[model samples]
Target: MRTQIAIVGGGPAGLLLSQLLNRVGISTVVLERKSRDYVLSRIRAGVLEWGTVELLRTAGVGERMDHEGMPHDGCYLAHDGRMFRVDFRDACGRQVMVYGQTEMTRDLYAAQDAMGATIIHDAEEVALHELDGEAPFVTWTHDGKPFRLDCDFVAGCDGFHGVSRPSIPKEVRREFEKVYPFGWLGVLSHTPPLADELIYASHERGFALASMRNPNLSRYYIQVPLTDHVEDWSDDAFWQELKRRLPEEVAERLVTGPSIEKSIAPLRSFVSEPMRWGKLFLCGDAAHIVPPTGAKGLNLAVSDVHYLAEALKLFYSSGDGSALDGYSEQALSRVWKAMRFSWWMTTLMHRFTEHNAYERRMQDTELAFLECSAAAQAVMAENYTGLPY
Candidate 1:
């Protein structure tokens, strides 16, 4: 098969990129290792930066989101038994949409189908060929048969463990990583949210987040040790532990129920530099990762798509590669800023093994400063809503 662009993953990044490109008369194919059902079943971050919402709309997939997604103007930060709200709209003239990533993926898939874009799922052993040269292609297996895809450029949206990033020669690629000492034990349930907007609590015990997919479905997470497993905590136990970490008032009114889904996710901050290496470019988790504390995961993917999609359009239209040439640098500039914000939020909210009393006090002090100072609140709001594309 021949196409203008070959996308290595069918997740939100790859699908969104394909949808965006196809809308502009570009032909692209998406190859996914997992089944479509498997991809949609994966639950991910729900917070959406305003820019991400706009991108989804531009991709022709935002109708459902705009209809069903809740708009959040502020979120609460709880520290030392009191909670303060950061008004994002007031501070930065922007608000985020609380739409689950799973829903976003479904919308993208529907849009792709409407556009008649080619998306091949259950593709296995995908490999890149001659990405360093002018001509590049992708090879993979589907239903025990081998297939080859010829394309002008390859996009590696396959994620952290996917083959696309590793295809770049190790001698040419440099990675920076930091694994946090804790993980997030998340619980999903069909219960009313504990509050109108999300609450991020920083307590002496640990950190806890109260979020929602809709008014009837809620998602919550509490910091845990790396050693904890899903079997180690029951729904009742998880609720008890979570309550202990939240403020008394919020806890008193909090609703508890059986967890529909439960999992533990390790926190980490990682980045792979030079997102573009020759004809192959990396997007989203293929190139970087951030802790969930900052809700930057999917937003980062959208931003990368913004840069790469625009660059590819320019390349195909005017035969100019300047934007394409600057994809890596342009994407990395925003990537590093987001990485810093996620790291800072993780450090301020979670309890670390090495945190001394001084460090704990420092966290509380920072929260206090954030509550009292409009400048600090604006800074947080700006970063939380998103930086820019």
Candidate 2:
């Protein structure tokens, strides 16, 4: 098989890239190691930066999102048994959209299918060849049959554990990572949200986040030890712990119900520098990862896709390879900013076991400063709403 670009993952990053490029008459093929059902079944964060919301609209998959997704001007921060709101619009003249990653992926898939775009699911043992040469190709197996796809370029949107990142020779790739000592015990419930907007709580016990996917669906999380397991907490136990961490007033109005989904996700900040190597370009989790505190994982990937898609479009249209040559530097600049923001948020909200009393007081003082200072709030709003593309 032959295509202009071979996308090595069918997740939102790859599908959105394909959607954007296809609209401009570029050809792409997406390969996935799992079935379509498996991809859509995975639950993920819903908060969308204003820029990400706009990009989805540009990709022609935002109709459903704009119709069903919740748009919030700002979110709440809880500390010392009290909560304060940061008005993103008032401070930065922007807002974020609350739309689940699963829903966006579904929309992308629907758009891709309607356009007859190529997406091959259940592709195993995917490998890249000649990535440093003029000719690049991808190979994988399906039903015990070998297949090869020749393409002008390869997009490594296959995520952190996928083959794309490892394909880059260790001698050329540089990686930086920080694994947090804690994880988030998240639950999805069929109930109304505790508040109109998301609330991030920093309590004496731990960190908690009150979020929602829609009016009837609420998502909540509480910080937990890394050694904890999903089976360790029952639905009642989870809700009880969450309520303890939330503000008394906010917890009073909280509605509890059977959890539809539950899981524990460890926090981490990772980045593999130089997102591009020869004909291969990395996007999303394949290039960088941020803790969920800043809601940057999916949004960061979308930004990478935006850069690579535009670069490829320019290369094909104007015969200008300069943008392609600069893709890594351009994306990394924004990636590092997001990394800093996520790290800062994670440090501020979580109760780190390693932090001494002085360090804890510092965290408390920082949040207190952000609560009262307009300048600090504006900075938070700007970073939370997202930096410019």
Candidate 3:
């Protein structure tokens, strides 16, 4: 099989890139090792930047999102039983939508299928070719038959573990990483949210977050030791900890159904410089990863692919590789900014024993400023809701 562009990984980045390219009359093929159902059902980051929502709407895939996703104008930061609302709407005149990443994938998948784009799922032994050359393609097996895809260019939206980034020469690539001592133990349940907006609580007990997937389902997370195991948390124990962490008033309304799912994700911030190498380009988690505190993971993925789609369009039409050449540097500028924001959020809200008396007092001072000063609140609001893509 041959196409103009061969996309590796059918996650949001690859799928969205294929969709955007297809819309502009560029032919592409997407390869994935998992089934379409699996891709559509993977739960991930939900908060959508206002610009991201607009892009999806313009791309003809935002109808269901607009219908089912709740608009959050702001979020609450709670500390020592006090609530400080950061009004994103007031700060930037834009509101974020609380919709699950699964829903976004479904929308994109449906749109791509309807447009007759090529998306191969359940393909095994997927391998990349020509990583060091001007031409690159994917080789895989589908239904026990060997197949090869030859394309003009390759896009590695395959994520951090995929072959895309590893293809870059190690000597030339620079990697920056920081692993945190904490992780988030998240639970999904069939309960309505305790509040309309997300609540980020920095309690003496721990850090807790109250978020909603929709009106009928809620998602919550608590900070835990990075080495903690999921089996260590019992349902009853989870609820008791939640109650201790949340504000008194909010805790009263909190209700959890049997946990439909639970897992712990380690917190880390990593960035790989130079997102492009030759005709191959990397986007999304393949190039950078941010801790979940800022809710920037999926949004950054969307932003990277959006810029990529635009660049690819110009490349395919005019043969001017300027955009592709600058993809890494351009995307990294925004990626690093988000990395800083997520790191700041994680450190400011979570407790650390190593913190001295002065360091401990500084957190309280920062929270007080965020609560009382309009300027401080505005800064939080802007970063929380997101910076313009």
TM-score of 1: 0.99
Q: Which of the numbered candidates is closest to the native, going by highest lDDT? A: 2
Evaluate model 1: give its lDDT: 0.95
lDDT of 2 by residue, 24-124 (tens): 99999999999999999999989999999999999999999999999999999999999999999999999999999999999999999999999999999
Q: Please provide, for model 1 over 1-389, each residue's C-alpha lDDT reduced to its tens digit, 9 standing for 90 to 100.
A: 99999999999999999999999999999999999999999999999999999989888899999999999999999998989899999999999999999999999999899878999999998999999898899999988899999999999999999999999999899999999999999999999999999999998889999999999999999999999999999999999999999999899999999999999999999999879988999999999999999999999999999999999999999999999999999999999999999998999899998989999899999999999999998999999999978
Which residue pairs overlap in candidate 2's backbone? none
In candidate 3, what residue range of length 10 has the lowest lDDT sum? 380-389
Tell me the TM-score of model 3: 0.97
Q: By lDDT, highest first, what's the ranking? A: 2, 1, 3
- For model 1 the local lDDT of residue 302 reads 94
lDDT of 3 by residue, 1-389 (tens): 89989999999888888988999999999999899888876779889988789888977889999999999999999998878788887876778999899999999999998999999999788787886676778899988999999888888888888878888889868999998888899999899998999999998767999998998899999999877899999978888898889989889879877899899998889999888887788889989999999999999998898889989899889999898878888889889988988999989898776788898789878888888888877777777776776
Candidate 1: minimum summed lDDT over ten consecutive residues — where?
A: 270-279
- Candidate 3's clash total is 0
Off by over 4 Å in 2: none
